[model samples]
Target: MKTALQMSLAAAASLSVFTATAAHAHVSVSGPAFAGATHEATFGVGHGCDGADTYRVKVQIPAGVTSVRPLDSTFGKAVLEKNAEGNVTAVVWTKPLADVLPADTNYYKLALRFKVPDAPFTTLYFPTTQTCRSEAGVETTVAWSDTSGEHGSHDADAGTPATSPAPSLFILPARSPGWNKYTVNQHVHDLSVFNDALIVWAGKAAYSANPATQSLITTEPDTEVLSEIHPGTEIWVKY
Candidate 1:
């Protein structure tokens, strides 16, 4: 016979992924990547600046993400910018003037293959800048590089609308068919995203349907509960 906790955990789902793609959405990256795994992030561009056709797109790669290689884009040539340390700092895709005619008013997806950091439960942001050119030869740019607030404030996928939001997404641990263990690298405020998770716990702290009833935890005594899980805090979940 199976234990109640085992059955509950087995039936539970993995972590939650939050995105805020409302009106005036900026450049956004899409994916549910596993920790330390290779990911091909696709940044989506909806439109140009004030009806101007897109000419270039530059995406800034955050730290801890390694071995980045931008894929070829039909829109233009993809190039990478690297720091003195030999790490890729940014990936820029520029469309040729030949194709810019009649305005490349359509949406675009710029891809980059790389390895996410080993830290699980971390949200990484790729600050991006989009350049546009008008038929009259006027040029403009949109800096989608504000990585503040939830999921990098003003993100097209989540959080309060911002004037400029960075492209961001969570890199979580690879889960098995049953129960899985994870140690979060950031503070998570809401546990509701894991609604399917039957329970979550760390040390003596545990939560079933509400904030963990423990006063303090052995793992991370200060922030160990469903409502507030701090960094370096180890937790287990049912798949």
Candidate 2:
């Protein structure tokens, strides 16, 4: 909807692109959780390594997330691994040697619920590893703990570059008045979130939904300057 207000947008600087995990059936997570909210993180493993059967699954708990409790799974009870200071560091799920299935026949979903920290946050990834073993005593492992690369908060048309992508979670911050800096976890197209902000600044462009401006600086033809929100976009919004 075009409003009567003239919005003046300008270019800022060049930026890198971000691609989140979605199409890949290997490993992934669910989120964009609100700051300070309790979240249940689920790690989905679709297959074992090199056609071997899965034997163990380990997931590292990121900082600031509190009160983590692993949910039960068919693989058995969840084992808590802690740090020297008595803080739980990771969660493990193991399958007995006799129960190891062959190849990709099994899909595993292991989850842990925890309370998120209050805002002044962005994206979080729980580094996970999947270990597989064969009857002959051969063990193969695939670690989905890479935290490199970038993606849009919207997780748009792009796919992750990680061969074994870790399950990721996004944090939606608690906004404050005046200017607030945020990273986009989900793609945003509507300008409503910044409705009252005087102007928003992303990489090489600026957006103002103040409805009192008089121009546009669109990078793409027919698309608004702020239309494409990157997965890891750190944008500044003013109230």
Candidate 3:
């Protein structure tokens, strides 16, 4: 019962909302974001291309990252592409069989661990391509390879293609002790091997690891002695 003008305006509003959602749904890489450290990068894929099923995801490794090892995924098989210098340059995870995955499966989370170079305060971009296959075997590729200006700014703009934004990680500066520091997203267990003289900063309080006791002891007696540090805890160790 709406007028033609009203209907056009409603459709435009819906389209704008859809575009904003799509722009924010681009593949993203997240991790400790520290330089000179071994970082586990998690590549998040929110959805597949349109209504298609994502069959494969390929991520290009930027320069200065080495010893790339893709984590195992229940949804797909991981493959590595090595350069002539025997260094990994890219990693691809492909579904072994379409029937093995759920019919409604669209989202994927892939991870890889690599050593970030000593370049501090730098942003690393991983250009990724997602291959979506329809039921009829039609393949569609969405490239997430834009590293211009600010992250997601270009894609969020109107008229930009959906799913053409690259995943980026902000490398933080290296800490002292000639060892890099990393802030994990969750509490870390099993710090037995790291029994050396290391420092852990939880909030404003600092705790040092006692090599003899293999425990983290607080500098201040009143401060809490932590067995397991919570998320956002920064630790500096000599690697």
Top candidate when judged by lDDT against the true structure:
1
Which digits, one per residue and each the tens of the lDDT, describe model 3 over residues 71-106?
Answer: 978768789998899989899998875443334365
Worst 10 residues of 2 by lDDT: 9-18
Q: Flag regions of model 2 displaced more than 4 Å.
A: 1-25, 151-160, 174-224, 227-239
Question: Each prediction's TM-score against the native?
Answer: 0.75, 0.64, 0.58
Local accuracy of candidate 2 as per-residue lDDT tens digits, 70-158:
99898867999988978788999998777887654788788889988774335577888888888677898888876644322323323
Clash number by candidate, in order: 6, 18, 0
Please give the RMSD to the true structure for each candidate, in Å.
6.3, 8.7, 18.7
Q: Write the per-residue lDDT of candidate 1 for residues 136-214, one digit (tens) a residue.
A: 9899988987666555322233455556777777666776754678877666665543444456676655665422322
Model 3 local distance difference test score? 0.62
Q: Judge candidate 3 at residue 131 and give its lDDT.
A: 86
What local lDDT does model 3 show for residue 111? 90
Regarding lDDT, does 1 or 2 come out ahead? 1
